[model samples]
Target: MSWFSPSRLVPSRLVPSLPPYSGPYPVGSCDVELSAADLPSPGSPPPNAPATIAFRLFYPAAGSGPSRPIRWLPSPQKAHFAAYARFLGAGSLLSTAVSLAPNVLYYTTIPARRNAPLLHPPGPAWPVLVFSHGLAGSRNAYSALLGELASHGIIVVAPEHRDGSAPMAFVRAPDGGASTSVSYQIHPHKPTAEVYAARDAQVRIRGWEIGVLYAALEKIGEGAEMRNLDPNLGVGGVEEDVLGSFVGRLDLRPGRVAWAGHSFGAATVVTVVKSAYYGGEEMGGPFIPARDAGIVRQITKSSVLALLDMWALPLTSPSAEQFFEKQLPAYEPGGAGGKAVLSVLSEAFWRWHGNLNDTKVVLAPRTAVSDDDEKVEQERRGPYIFYPEASAHLSQSDFGILFPWITGRVLKATEPERYLRLNVRAILQVLRENGTVVAGYSPLEGEEPLDGGGEGKKGGDWRILNPEGGVRGWLPVDMEVTSEDRRMSIGEETGGRNDEVRETEVLGDVKL
Candidate 1:
């Protein structure tokens, strides 16, 4: 008689002990913001000085019928034993108590929601898509997309790239060493005159934080250095060393993962793709000499379903040059080399000063306002007429989705729905062809605001990015995109640019 039982191969318990947590969900759909307090400066205060890095999880609604929720096959007893060891290390004496605890694994850490196991009868495990948010924004930004994916029977795990997010708080021991009780805190910049000063700081922080998350996931489930605190610690203060070890421990069964981001978050995704961090296409060309197994392998193994970038386009292209020239006059070199040279300064100064005002023109208002606008009976006449151009165009890309309020404020007016549709389609096409799960959310074309709505509403621009396009199922967008026909629009900033000559700022001098 076979004493061994086939049933022993699978663990009896299937449901995660943790209860589905639905804390106070923030009102409105996906959106981002920047204020004067977030601006960057040469001296003064530290970056993210008053910002918080945070995120939220959105699980798919329950599925029905035969095709049930996927389950991890032949659950590894060793992994469970290791988790038990970690629980012991954390100093809980009741071993049985810990084991018996309901919702132990899922609820033990964050009060987050998880989808029901296997939507129907037991089936194959669902593919997992991981998301990272834009700079200064939290994981919560992607809730709309994540929730949508979950509804379709996909399991999504969105980790807070803490460093990439707003400043976070952690616990430390008496000796100032990090303790396990680290709790997160949000220190938003105090509201002031400036719009967004810390944009770059948030970007840099996001880059480092994504790197940590990638490294951590890559190491999950491999007991090599299991003793280190990490994805294991109930709190969030794991050292890089510990994090690296934890990622190495992951049971990342082959051929089932993809990566994505929004706005600056999308840039992070590009970095991961460009560096081949999560396994993608080869990073070839002048800037990057070689390729890696990260994104390339991820695509090959996991089949990146889609790369959903909100209206974000590469900055190096000629279209971007035309866009800058046509939109921001102060950005024009006024014979300042090519448009690239001027745009760099424009971005930097925007990061620093948080507004559009030339020093020379400040002393001489005539130079700021064009002779044409002066002749016309316009109340405000300046080099560039702050219309809904840049923000309108930028919002079509991921930038708008990440910072909607800023986009609306900068652009001044909301645009049409067709524009939003075009961008969302572009992003969806790129990600799907690359072999990853993806979705692009945008506002409906020609959407009207309520009586009290429009530009005056706080975070109104956010509506433009996530318009009510009513959940369109995953129909992949056609790719063959190019910049030939679509010339960048020349906003009111035209004319006066020819007369002004501002010194160009070199790329090396600009901070990342």
Candidate 2:
């Protein structure tokens, strides 16, 4: 824990390495796509989907041993890049022209060692975190951010959801049969009945996948038999039991395991928390733990929540809106309170006044009368919320870092790594405050410390959730703003361009 601090973080001069993690720990990662047969889905699988779950686990490595670099894209490189080309509408099914664009970039690599040994920290147990990706995203898409978190000593699991949200994924059968290509199921972002039904179906599938992952973690903790369905897990050679190395390592205590997501994935986290923690609501209650074997008790009120640029439309979809209108699970008795929840919104998302307002409802604390005293029903301090000025929704993921040239030239994303560092700083502080033993220091904007000196010049003081614009471009959201001003401020803040139409609800989660 006494090594490489934020100030001392050295960026990988090499192009393939992701932005170097600021935390003191070295990171390792592995791919795991397991059969859902024994894990069992609580509900019917999403229409035309397989009974499988997939993800990449990034964690603090045990030793500085010789390691293999994790590819930014999984194997069958050109095919995966072609899917991205198709998803971006840059190419038709047979358009080799556009497909070649990502092909040129397919060789880029993640900054983690492949299937390296998991670090055994000098603590009771290593904390664990589960992260979900957004629309058109896979487990590899967010490796930079997740690896940053893992570099701080937590085991981070990024689930690859096959509910038609991904651009394209290869789903291998439970018995290691032929893999089937599952393409993205694009739906209208409008709040129409059909769209709601489509998204509601996705949430169910995603919730079930998360539950199954927790079950896998339980077995991995006990050194039980489990199979990783990733076709490329043993591509080079089987050096060791990477899956078995996780035995008795992860901390699964109630609230100890954190949950996070971005955009549509973030909406899934909101619904999953409600579905798993507070069943019996309008949605017929508790969908994930339908049977006793789910082992989702770890998903309690105390579990930490980190949501980034959460797309609000899915939460308001026709089916589960009623269930989630209530407070988040963190507000329950023995709950972790507002500090347990952190939402790092992007400036682009902030311009979408309506969506921003919806985000507030999801993160803000609601008041209720207690019959006699009229006391507050929720914690006075709401979730920690902020936005790094000039950032886009893609800033929180590896997209900006991976495609800095295109993003900078076209999307106008500058200093993408700085945005990611800001996110990691906030998240690490959140974990440390929650009783998880991590690095003791996360320097603020105007402060000088070890690891060298002042690296972040503006807004990293996560402790004071409401810095009221004191932290320069890192603007703390004023939850009390009026809806009228909210709409007008979108133009005011972003110079009237409203550059991002989706955050404005026009494009929605569609990257294009």
Candidate 3:
């Protein structure tokens, strides 16, 4: 066996045909009421200007309580404007109104389809979900998924990661002149480790901020209606505490909290959960009254229920095994003195488990094989199979953030709406595990039953089935690669013109 330097697999940019580069919209702006008089007519041009890439939100009605919103945060790739336009064009069926309000987000509190009157007040507390944008992305990247989730009962928070989002600055080309711009945070000599380190730092920081903000929102509640209208408030400076409080103004339960970020945001949630737990630990058992320690112990046991990573890859893979085996000195077992918290944190995101119980896991591209897999066919290109050189960006904190862009280029396009409807189930699973509501008959009408794997099954019941088994959409796809089999690639993109050789070394039989 031989060792390879870690710097050779630097990520390179592939300029796809241009797409719409919409910025993050304010969470308050989405307003689509089909019953309202301001809707657009079919086949007619939009009566309103297009707002920042559009999305929808749905929550339970008054009696049912507030639910989470599924959020769609899109990457800001300027070239894809046309694609976005087409998306909205197709999405009109979900709404009666069409407006392109630049910089303004569109939000609506809708009830799920039960054909009931709108008299019931929503339930007391609502669960929470946050959508994270990818590198060089804005907060409104995935309108397809966001709108669909909002249509249900989820409170979705999409945060704009400051480190690598699309900037407001731009060079306007002269009339009929073309403009060119590079991706945000682009680098010549990309260090995979440095990039991962930076992303983890940024996402964790943002996640903590998000948690704080949401807590504040719970306190604000209905006060938002009053404060939201004030003319003096600035959009960016509006106290997150105030915003948090305002959203929380409605009397409700904190319910369950869940975070799902694309790309780096995914990594962000994982870090923040650990951070929240760590912080809670430091706070000394929740400040309970002298006798409440017993209750506190049980309560704090599983504060965080589940973490969902959409297309995320571990930090240093197949390679980390050897580095631990040969290069790095071993730590004295269980020695707090040797276990540096930050170092572990730096590596915290290097490897992650989407399941609450770290052992059970779900990896994407179920069909995609890694270079280390037995059927390492060079021609096959998809996540099911991994290629050492292909996933150069795995080192970055937010891996799924690039889902839209990456999914756009390499595979057949799935309607964003369809994907959202399917993905929300996984989120609900997280909520259920967190002690939230059970899957009501209404929400589970079309859901499939697991053959042998879920709560109902006894032996070897991992088989989950959808109502339509042949076309099951979002089930977990597990791969053979474990923490021990993955490796890291370091180096610049080789053969500038050659698309084939993208890495410095290929570690076979190693976990991806």
Predicted candidate 1 versus true structure: per-residue lDDT over 207-259, tens digit per residue:
43444333333433233232222222121322222222122223245434555
lDDT of each: 0.30, 0.69, 0.30
Residue 138 lDDT (model 2)? 89
| Cα shift from native, residue 385, model 1 (Å) | 29
- Worst-scoring 10-residue span by lDDT in model 2: 503-512
Q: Which ten residues in a row have the lowest lDDT in candidate 3?
A: 337-346
Q: Sort the candidates on lDDT, descending order.
A: 2, 3, 1
lDDT of 3 by residue, 1-512 (tens): 11211122311132111122111111222311111112211111222211112112223323233223322322232333323333234433211122232112112111132111122224554455555554444444444344344334455555544333333212223232443332344322243666545444444335434443343334344443322221112233332222332254232332244445544454444344333333333222111112222111211223332232232322222222221122111111211111111011111122322211121122111234467743333222212211111122222222122233332233222332233333444444434434544223132323445444445543111121222233344332333455533332222223332222111111000111
Best candidate per lDDT, number? 2
Candidate 2 stretches with Cα past 4 Å from truth are: 1-17, 40-49, 91-103, 231-236, 285-288, 291-296, 368-378, 442-470, 481-500, 503-512
On a 0 to 100 scale, what is the lDDT of residue 473 in model 1? 20
> Can you list the residue pairs that collide in candidate 2?
221-248, 255-303, 279-286, 280-285, 502-508
* TM-scores, all models, native as reference: 0.36, 0.84, 0.45
